[model samples]
Target: MADPLLVVPVREGTATVSLRLFRTATGDRTAVAFSSPLALARVLGPGQRWIRLSAPALRHMVADLGVTGIVLDPAGTLPPRSPATGHDVHRLRVA
Candidate 1:
C-alpha cells in the first residue's frame, strides 16, 4: 500500500484543520483528528493567516500511515493576509 496522504484544509480564524489519512488507490479517508489553529501551530509552525502544523505532527501522521515518508501539500491554500517575506518550507526531521 502507498503512503497515506495528509489533507489539511487551511482557512482563516480558528477553523478546523482536518487530518485525513487517505489512500489514493483505494480512495479511503480515515479521519485522524480535527486540529485547531492553536494546536496545529504547536506542531507545524506559525502561519500569517492560517494555522500551521509542526514537524512532529507531520512525522507522527506519516508514522501512523505506516510509512517513512509522505507528501505535504498545502492544497494551494494560504492565509487571508498578504504573503510574508520568509522561507516557504521549514526543514524538520523524524527521530
Candidate 2:
C-alpha cells in the first residue's frame, strides 16, 4: 500500500487512459495492479504498457465504475514472452 503500484491502462476509442478492469469467475468486476514494474512484465509480458498509481488512488478510480475489488501482484495469466528469445517468431504468406 505504501509503494506506488504499476497499473495497466486501456484506451477505448479515446486517447485518455483508463484503469484496466478484469472479470472474476463469479462475474464481478475487479481491478488489477502490480507491486512493481518487473512484477507487471512477468505477468503481462515485457512489451505491456503501464502506469504508476498508489493503491488508494487506484481503488478510488475503480470504485466509480462499481469495481470494489483489487487484485495485487496476481500471478501471470500466461507465460511471458520476449522477442530476444525468438520463441514467438512466425511467418505469414500473402494470399
Cα-based lDDT for every prediction: 0.38, 0.60
Best by lDDT: 2
Across 26-70, the per-residue lDDT of candidate 2 in tens digits comes to 656777777777877776677766788877788778777877577
TM-score of 1: 0.26
Q: Tell me the lDDT of model 1 at 46.
A: 61
Any runs in candidate 2 off by more than 4 Å, and if so which? 1-14, 78-95
Residue lDDT tens for model 1, 4-85: 4333424333554434333323333322212455443444446523434554566665566554344443222322322364
lDDT of residue 69 for candidate 1: 44
For candidate 2, the TM-score is: 0.65
Angstrom error of the Cα, residue 23, model 1: value is 2.0
